[model samples]
Target: MDLFSLKGKRALVTGGTHGLGMAMAEGLAVAGAELIITGTTPTKMDDALSYYKRKGFKAYGYLFDVTNEKVAKENISKITKEIGEIHILVNNAGIIKRELAITMPVEDFRRVIEVDLVGPFIMSQLVAKQMIDRKEGKIINICSMMSELGRNSVSAYAAAKGGLKMLTQNLATEWAKYNIQVNGIGPGYFATSQTEPIRVDGHPFNEFIINRTPAARWGNPEDLAGAAVFLASKASDFVNGQVIYVDGGILATIGKPSNED
Candidate 1:
């Protein structure tokens, strides 16, 4: 349990104002990490800060576009000056455009790539420089099932995530010697507000997810907390460049036939 403690550690989570990012950030806070959350929305940031404070966690918020390397660099510097040096970085900021590859605009595809893949790259580079100097750090990229399998209407997303998986491994290999661990968390279908509509009874997509997952249910946002904590703490010091899938066994097997038990 001591190995899992993150006391006195500063964790910077990009896009952490809501959804799964918030869930993971909360997990880190519960394990004693000081939170430095980043997001693009002011209202969301305020709400998240209030929530964290209400829960008695030390938290700070910064707003910025992570994909813009220049702005991100400035903000990272500002954060270090005002808050503290970052010991853990969760590259969870990303975007997806649900359009068919055939019909998707090149700009939209590029935008998705910029945010989902390049944003992590930018954030990691800036943060890892500090970690390299200190000789220790943790980096967790939020990946997805698309990182492994192809899905309809998500061509750009799959491409970016697949690239991210490789990037995780590559970064881990390079930084392992410096005692910096780079890992990824690939989530499965989850019961988020974004998915609430499709998660209701008898919805085709909801039923599909329920039947598809070996665990027989969609993942709860909280289901991600433990993995996030592990990857950010001393518990995973030796774990590097790996993507831990939290998709309820969705990737462990081919989907069962709709008629099969």
Candidate 2:
């Protein structure tokens, strides 16, 4: 059991105030790591920080935008200088805009790409430099089921995620000898604020997901906990450049609606 522990580790997660990022933060916290979660809003960060502090968990929050390379570098550097080096990083900040390619504005597409793809690249590069000097670290990128397959009106999101998958591999290839493990989590549809609109529209989406997935259900955020902990802990010392999908068997299926349940 202790083999999966992250005791004495310090972790940083971007966009960690809500949804999968928040879930990942909690998972790391429960695994005994001190957590620093970043977001753009002070209120949300404060709320998350307050909750963890009240729970007697070691947690903090910073208002920073990962898309801003200058701020990302400055704040992260400040954090390491003040609190100690962050041994783990979860690149979980991202955005999506749904529109047909023909009608999609180039600016909107670029916005998604900037936040989703470019932001992670910069964050990983900056953090990997620190990790390289230390010769040990864990970096987890939050990819999406889109990394494997695309859906309608989300070409930019798919493209960004797909790029992230390869980026994870590339980073692992270059940094493995330095003792850094770079991996990604490609999540399927999970119940979160970001997905609440679709979930509330109910039947069509639920039916589609249940029939599509062999597991016959939508995933919850908690479903990703063990994977995050494993990748962050010493247990994954040999794991690198991998994208683990937590999609309730959605990715494993073909065209058939497997109603095994």
Candidate 3:
């Protein structure tokens, strides 16, 4: 058997219109799974679907707000019916507010929590029901370095991700008996279009990230593909409740002083 192959599987990736989510979805597709991605806007959905189609990959897109439980449930049912049984789910939909805790509005904080943490809870629960009935599934939650370490101006995001880590664990514990594996992927800084300005050769944050990470560079979105595929495929059947940090060994050491070398 090709243990890593995802043939005959159908995957649902939330917030996969672009960036890291789209990268992971592409990985699953390359591994032979049919892809269904969710986005909040029809334009983004259509564009993403077209992008995949142009690349000769079979992909579908749906417009839905993952944070709305009713919408999530309804859409998930529609997907299962119209597409196929979703054997893999990637809860990549999330939001982050880069406001200082003391100055951040309560509503903004709540909104981040709702989208980042609560949304995943609802999505997982709805998808797990079908998996439970089938007695097999894989769930990958897109966590972050915030899940373990905290940074300035992102308190709400940190709290939500920290909660998501535990949520991944709890779901794994509860669903393992039914052959469901719940895991998280904690990505570090990646060099995406959104980070292009900061990724300049001598930018302060760029310097910090290069020095901080043992790999000495920002991660490419494609860097996450293997991890995503592993967690989404039968290759990870025995793994459960783990958060694989794809941070280029940043979490492994504090850092070398600038003067040390």
Candidate 4:
């Protein structure tokens, strides 16, 4: 009877093969939602599907590149045909490429935008239409620290994430009348496949991160899952167009690092 429980709901997560995507899917599955995950790699998809299957969770995988509108529409249609209406959508699929803006190729920037920004827009539009017919839905966009603050290099990623923030609000403002709650979760530095290089390098970046973050550590994937579930459940029915920061207080601090007194 908990408001946060996802029992009897169906969720479709884009980019659910690995990293944060898989973590979110698993979180929803554990919350008792039937999960459908999409990704580009069949091998990874099969792996995730089998892993969840072994866990006795109802999970399925669809192969499609979300950046491609045609492919996205096609896969969505196919999924709708196979499964009934998807009540929850977790737009967790994204890509990050670090490069200096001046030196970065425009093609790389466009590609990142295609996947991180436009892809989410397409999926949200497609799914929101279906939710409109049902008069209810939940949309959780996976944003980033870069959505509000920027760092050295990675201009395209910053732009894409920032745009995603606004897109989330736009969707919520327009869709709230239909009983849909659209919101976002902006994660700070998290240890995942995306950050393995930084972790493996044992660079000062990690130290800087710990010192900068009030929590003094990077977040794990599970940290964001609870927020996703909350946003997707009845607990957050009134929450709309808001971006929750699960950054361990990274966004709260400014100035140089300080050691304990």
Candidate that would win on lDDT: 1
Kindly indicate the candidate among 1 and 3 with the higher lDDT.
1
Ranking by TM-score: 1, 3, 4, 2
The lDDT values for all models are 0.96, 0.90, 0.93, 0.90
Q: Please report how far candidate 3 places residue 147 from its true position, in Å.
A: 0.5
Candidate 1: minimum summed lDDT over ten consecutive residues — where? 191-200
TM-score of each: 0.99, 0.96, 0.98, 0.96
What tens digits encode model 3's per-residue C-alpha lDDT throughout 1-261? 488899899999999999999999999899998999998988888889999898888898889899988888899899988887889999999988899888999999999999999999999999999999999999999999999999999999999999999999999999999999999999999988789999988789998999899898899999999999999887899999999999999999999986564
Instruction: List the candidate 3 regions with Cα displacement exceeding 4 Å.
Output: none
lDDT of 2 at 54: 80
lDDT of 4 by residue, 1-261 (tens): 579889889999998889888888888888889999998989999999999899899998899888888889988899999987889999988988889998999999999999999999999999999999999999999898899988899899999999999999999999999999999999988899767777654587877777788887889998878988899899999999999999999788783535652
lDDT of 2 by residue, 136-234 (tens): 999999999999997999999999999999999999999999999999998888888766666654568766776787776778999998889999999
What ranges in model 2 sit over 4 Å off? Answer: 200-202, 258-261
Evaluated against the true structure, the overall lDDT of model 4 is: 0.90
The prediction achieving the highest TM-score against the true structure is: 1
Please report how far candidate 1 places residue 40 from its true position, in Å. 0.5
TM-score (C-alpha) between model 2 and the true structure: 0.96
Model 1 per-residue lDDT tens digits across residues 120-224: 999999999999999999999999999999999999999999999999999999999999999999999988889998988999999899999999999999999
